[model samples]
Target: MSKVLIAYFSASGVTKNLAEKIAKENDYDIFEIVPQEIYTPADLDWTDKNSRSTKEMNDKSFRPPIVESTDVSGYDTVVIGFPVWWYTAPSIINTFIESVDLSGKTINAFCTSGGSGIDKCVNDLAATYPDLNFAKGLRLTGAESSEKIKEWISE
Candidate 1:
């Protein structure tokens, strides 16, 4: 069985494109972490303090509900991808992680952002879930070549 699973939460299509590339190159299974209530463009506005994204980012314990649950027991390694939200993974990501039992699995995190790196996102996940083997994460643009995806996965 293929032991790698690429799971991701992508509000916009940017992270989804990158996730597709990584999954295709690695011959891995892919799963989309969809939110129960989809975010509209207005809801995603970070500038508005009352916006959904802003409110979620402000509350550290907030967990945006995901549409479905996934079992990670079959996969030895999980590659999680998301857009960098307030310098970290989205709260829905926390909901996803908390739902699965990834105790001994290797977790490789990747994100897409306008200009920010994924250091804080990686660090946050590691700190929150100390048991999982958290691999170094990178910010990937959808334009990355197959060779680049292979290199990132192999690392």
Candidate 2:
């Protein structure tokens, strides 16, 4: 069996539940992309022009501070998960991919968003890790995504 890793970032536990379900279904190891500075509901208020998340999303180069890094060498497949931010994935995702040298690994991206899809995120990830193969991806609405994730995993 191929070794799989499910790594994700979730602020309100919506994405986390999805990640957990996929990991459990596939028997994949789980890794959480925890930020040094956690984002609360206040911090994620996109309506506020000056909100931290809004500002960070506006500045594409802003790197979210990661609490720790993990090695991906042992896993053949990595499912990178995150909540869509400002139509794109979180900057922390860039940080995660850069941290892991996924030279020849099979990377599958998954995401949870409000109403937007994961196309932007998938494209960005493909560009970022040109060497890795992006097999397939799943995107679920952040409201209640566990069942959707499980169905994707089964397929």
Candidate 3:
């Protein structure tokens, strides 16, 4: 089994693309954090207060059901990736984290965003899962070179 796993949730394809690139470059296992109900464009509209995304984000405790659970037992390091929503990870990330047994695994985070930095999301995950070994994090734009990704993961 591979030592590293790259798992991601993408409302659009941006984060998914980045995650696939990282996994392929590093020869790591990959998993998709799929929500039970896929998000449509209307559900993703941030301008609409009643949008599904807005409502989920507004309720910090909400964990949108995932389509399935991932098995992390074979991996020692897990790289979590997602698109930044409202300056932080979407609540579904909380659902994914809680679904798996990542107790002693090294958890690294990477995110794709228009402009938000990854610190808030990483900080939030670290705080939420204090027992896990949360390590490095990066903000990616999908155009990053393989060397840059390798350097970030190695760090």
Candidate 4:
């Protein structure tokens, strides 16, 4: 029996839906990343060119607060999920990784994106957590594609 942890940061509740499905399908414990200031659709307005999200994405010093952190030591494998932001994983993801010390564990990442592939994002995660094994990601969006995410987790 392999114990797993499913952790994710979702905006507008899209990624949260998929994250929940995967967790239920695998019976894994789930952790949601709640930033100090929640994001709304207007906040995510990319066209504004001055939105908080755009600012955070442009700068690297922003550290969003994670409401509830977890202990990853008990789990053999970790499934990390998020929505791609600016061709990379969200900066709050840094908060999640920093909260837990995953020195030699297996981590799988999945994300829902508009048109960006996850190669660069996975590379960044690998570089950040040099000691862990990061499995390839599942990139999809919408309810119809969430089934694929569940299927991949069961694999």
Best by lDDT: 3
TM-score of every candidate relative to the true structure: 0.94, 0.87, 0.95, 0.87
Model 3 gets an lDDT of 0.90
List per-prediction Cα lDDT, in the order shown. 0.88, 0.81, 0.90, 0.81
Residue-wise C-alpha lDDT for candidate 3, range 44-142, written one tens digit per residue: 999999999999999988999999988999888888999999888899999999999998888889999889999988998888888888887899987
What RMSD, rounded to one decimal, does every model reach? 1.4, 2.6, 1.4, 2.3
lDDT of 4 by residue, 23-124 (tens): 776578998988878898877887778987888888876777878788898987788888999899998898898889777767888888888887888899
> With candidate 3 superimposed using the best TM-score fit, by how many Å does residue 85's alpha carbon deviate from the native?
0.5
How many clashing residue pairs, candidate 4?
Answer: 0
Which is the winner by lDDT between candidate 1 and candidate 3? 3
In order, how many clashes per candidate? 0, 0, 0, 0
User: What does the lDDT come to for candidate 1?
Assistant: 0.88
Where in model 3 is the C-alpha error above 4 Å? Answer: none
- 64-95 per-residue lDDT for model 1 (tens digits): 98889898999988899999989899999999
CA displacement after TM-score superposition, residue 127 of candidate 3 (Å): 1.5
As a whole number from 0 to 100, the lDDT of residue 64 in candidate 2 is 88
lDDT of 2: 0.81
